[model samples]
Target chain A: MRSVQIPISDETIRSLEVGEPVALSGVMITGRDAAHKWMVDTFIKKTRQPEGDDQQVYAALKPILAGGVIYHCGPVVAGLDTKDYRFVAAGPTTSSREEPYQGDVMRHFNVKGVIGKGGMGPKTLAACQEAPGAYLHAIGGAASLIAQSVKRVLGVHKLDFGVPEAMWVIEVQDFPVVVTMDAHGRSQHAVIEAQSKSALEKLLAA
Target chain B: MQDLTEPILELVRLTSTDLPADVEQALRQAVEREAPGSAARGALETILKNVALSRANSTPICQDTGTPLFYVRHPAGWSTRSLRAQIESAVAQATAHAYLRPNSVDSLSGKNSGNNLGGHYFPTIHFEEVEGEALVIELMLKGGGCENVGAQYSLPHSQLGAGRDLAGVRKVVLDAVHQAQGQGCAPGILGVAIGGDRGSSYYASKEALLRKLDEPNPDESLAALEARLTQEANQLGIGPMGFGGETTVLDAKITHLNRLPASYFVSVSYMCWAYRRRKMVWKDGQVSYS
Candidate 1:
C-alpha cells in the first residue's frame, strides 16, 4: 500500500500502478453529477469566453484544483444550518455516472486524481493518461469508515445543487482507496469487467 | 397514532445502524471463502468492520440511508392514513437524529427536503389488510447505487436468445448481475420477480427482497433456481466490490407473479451488502422489534 499526500504531483500520480492500495491525505474537493456538469459547462467549455462570472468562478477554482483530487461523493452532513457541519457518512458514489464530464473536468482543472468507485469508461482511462492523473477507488458502502479519514470540512460550493450533489472541500488523512485507473493507462475495472463478461458467457453456455 | 411513533423511530434507527444477523453471517462466510490477502477479502473485511463500527456508534450503515420502504400488515379497521402520517413523522425524527440521511429531493427544482420527507411517495408505504389484530411493519433501506443497477426484461429477448421459460429467466437475471459488475456493490443480494406487468413486476422484485436472506422459497422449483443462480453468479469472479474472489452473490430470493398470457417479464432488484432491513410488531398496544 502506498501512502501519498494531496496536492499530489503528476510524477507521483504517474508512478502509481493499477491495483495498488493507497492511503491519501491532505485536502480534496467533493463533486458528483450536478457539480461535474456545472464545472464542465459553466467554467470549462466557456474558458475562453469570460462572460459574466464564469471567469471569476474559473479563477477561484484554478488554485485549489490545480494538482488536486476531485472526489465523487455526496456526504451526509450534520449541523448544516448551525454553521457547524460534521460528516456523518461519506462514501464514494458510482463513478460511471460522471463519466462523460470527468475527462474534461480532469484536463480542464489540471486535476491530478479522481477518487470514486465502480470506475469509468475508456474515455476516462485515456483522459487520466493524457492528464497524468489517477482514479482512486474507495470502498463503496464503507461510509462511516471513510468518514473517519476526513479530518475537517474546509468549505463548500454549489449549494444550489442540493446537499448530496453539492461540492464540499474537506481535509482528509489516511483516506483509503485503490488505484484502479492510474496515469500509466492501466485500469483494473476494465480488466475485471472483461473477465467477468467472459465468465458470464461460459455460465450461460452451461 | 401518537403511541406508534416511537416504535417506528426505533425501527428506523435499528435498520439504519445494525447489520441484520443473516447478512453478517453471509459476509463472514464470504470472507473465509476468499484467499488470504486478496482484494476481495480486504473489501469484505472493511465492510464487516464498518458494520461493527456503525452498530457500536449508532451511525448509518451507508451514507445513502436510501429510500425507506415500509411494508405494513394491519387489521381491517386500522387506518393506513394515520399510519402513513406516523411513519413520515418518525422518518423526519430519524433524519434529525442522523439515523437517516435526508434523501428526498425535489425532482423538478433539485431541492432537498432536508428531513427525508415531502417528495411524492417518499418513505414509500405499502399496506395489506390481514386478519391479524397485530400491526407488523418491515422496513428496508434501498440505496441508490444498487437501485440504479436494477433491470426489467421482457421475455423473448433476441439479444440474449431468451424465451418465455425458466431458462430465459435465468439468462436475463445473470445478465443483470454481470452488467452491475461492482457498481451495485457486489457480494450483493438479488430479489427477482418472474411474471406480472412492468410496474407490478418491478414492485414484486423489490418486495421479494423483504424475505430473510437464509430462507428459501416455499416452491421447490424456485428454491432450486435461487440456489443455482447464487452459485453461478459467484463463479463469475465479480466478487466483493468487484475485487474478484469466491463470493459475488450472498443470496438470491425469487418470487413469481401471475401474469397475462401476452406478457412475461423478469425484474431483478439488487441490494448491497449493507442490506438494512428490520421488522417491528405492534401487538395488544405493545410494540416489539426484531
Candidate 2:
C-alpha cells in the first residue's frame, strides 16, 4: 500500500501503478452523473465564448480542482435540517456512468485523480493518460468504513441536483482505494473483463 | 388499525443497519472458501467488519440506501391509500434519522425532495389483498451500483446464441453475470425471471430477490438450475469486489413467468451483498418484525 495526499501532482500520479492500493488524504471533491454533465456543459459553454476560458467557468472550483481528486460518490449526509452537514456513509458509485464526461472534466479542471469503483472505459483511460491522472477504485459497499476516512464536510455545490448527485467538497484522511487505471495507460478493468469473458466461455463448454 | 408509522420506521432502521442472518452466514462461508490473505478474502473481511460496525452504530450498511421497495399484503377492507401515506412518512423520518440516504429525485427536474418523499413511485409500494388477516410489509433497500448492472434479454438472442429454451435462459443469465464482473459488487446475488413482457419480466426479476438467500425454490428443476448457476458464476473467478477468488455470486434465484410466443424476455436483477431487507407483521392489534 502507498500513501497519497490530494492536490496530487502530475508527476506523482504518473508514478502510481495499476493494481496498487493507496491511502488517500487531503481535500477531494465529490460528484456523480448530474455534476459531471453540469461541469462539462459549463466547460464547453465557456470555451465557446470569445472572452471565456475553462478557468473562468471553473474559477470558483479552481482551488479544489487544480491537481486535485474528484470522487464519484453520492454520500448519505446527515444534519440537513440543522444546516450542519455530516456524512453518515460515503462510498464510491459505479464509475462507468460518468465515462462520457469524465475525460473532458479532468482536462478542463486539471484534476490529477478520479476516485470511483467499477472502473471506467477507454475514454476515461485515455483521459487519465492525457491529463496524467489516475482512476482510484474504492471498495464498493464499504460505505461506513469509507465514511470513517472523511474528516469533515467543507462545502457543497448544485444541491438542487439532489443530495446524492450534488457536488460535495470534503476533507479525508487515509481513504483507501486501488489504482485501477493509472497515468501510464494501464487499466485493471479492461484486463479483468477480458479474463472473465474467457472464463465464462470455459464454464459454458464444461 | 394501529398506527404503523413507528413500526415501519423501526423496520427501516433494522433493514438499513443489520445484515440479515442468512446473508451474513453466506458471506462467512465465502470468506472461508477464499485463499487466506488473498485480495478477495481481504475485501470480504472489510465488508464483514463494515457490517458489524454499521449494526453497532445504527448507520446505513451502504451509503446508497437505495430505492426502498415495499411489498405489502393486507387484509380485505384495509386502505392502501392510508398505508402508503404512513409509509412515506416513515421513510422521511428514516432519512432524517440517517437510517436511509435521501434518494427521492425528480428525474426530469433533477431536484431531490431532500426528505426521500414526493416523487412518483419514490418509495415504491406494491399492495396485494391476501387471504390472511395480518398486515405484512417487506422492505428491500436495493442500491444503485447493482441496479445499474441489471440486464434484460429478448430471447432468440443472436449475439449470445441464446434460443427460447432453458439452455438459452442459462446462457443469457450467465452472460449477465459475466458482463457484471466486479462492477456490480461481485459475490453478488442474481434474481432472474425467465419469461414475461419486458416490464413485467423486470418486475418479477426484482420480486424474485425478496426470497431469502438460503430458501430453495419450490420447483425442483428451477432449484437445481439456481444451484448450478451459482456454482458456475463463482467459477468465473470474479470473486469478492471482482478482485478474483472463489465466490462471484453468493446466490442465483429464478422465477418463471408465462409469456407471449413473440416475446420471450429474460430479466436479471443483480443485488449487492448489503442486501438490506426486513419484514414487519401486524396481527391481533400487536406488531412484530422479522
User: Which number leads on lDDT?
Assistant: 1
Q: TM-score: which candidate is best? A: 1
For all predicted structures, in order, the TM-scores are 0.97, 0.95
lDDT of 2 by residue, B184-260 (tens): 88889999998899999999999999899888999998998999999888878888887778999999989999999
* Candidate 1 collision pairs: none
Write down the RMSD of all candidates, one decimal each. 1.7, 2.3
- In candidate 2, clashing pairs total 0
- What digit string (tens of lDDT, one per residue) describes model 1 on residues A123-169? 99999999989999999889989999999998877666777888888
Q: Over the stretch B90-191, how does candidate 1's per-residue lDDT look in tens digits?
A: 999999888898889988877888888875599899999999778899999999999999999999898888899989899999999999999998889999
Runs in model 2 lying further than 4 Å from the true structure: A45-57
**Segments of candidate 1 deviating more than 4 angstroms:** A47-58
DockQ of each: 0.75, 0.72
Cα-based lDDT at residue B177, candidate 1 = 96
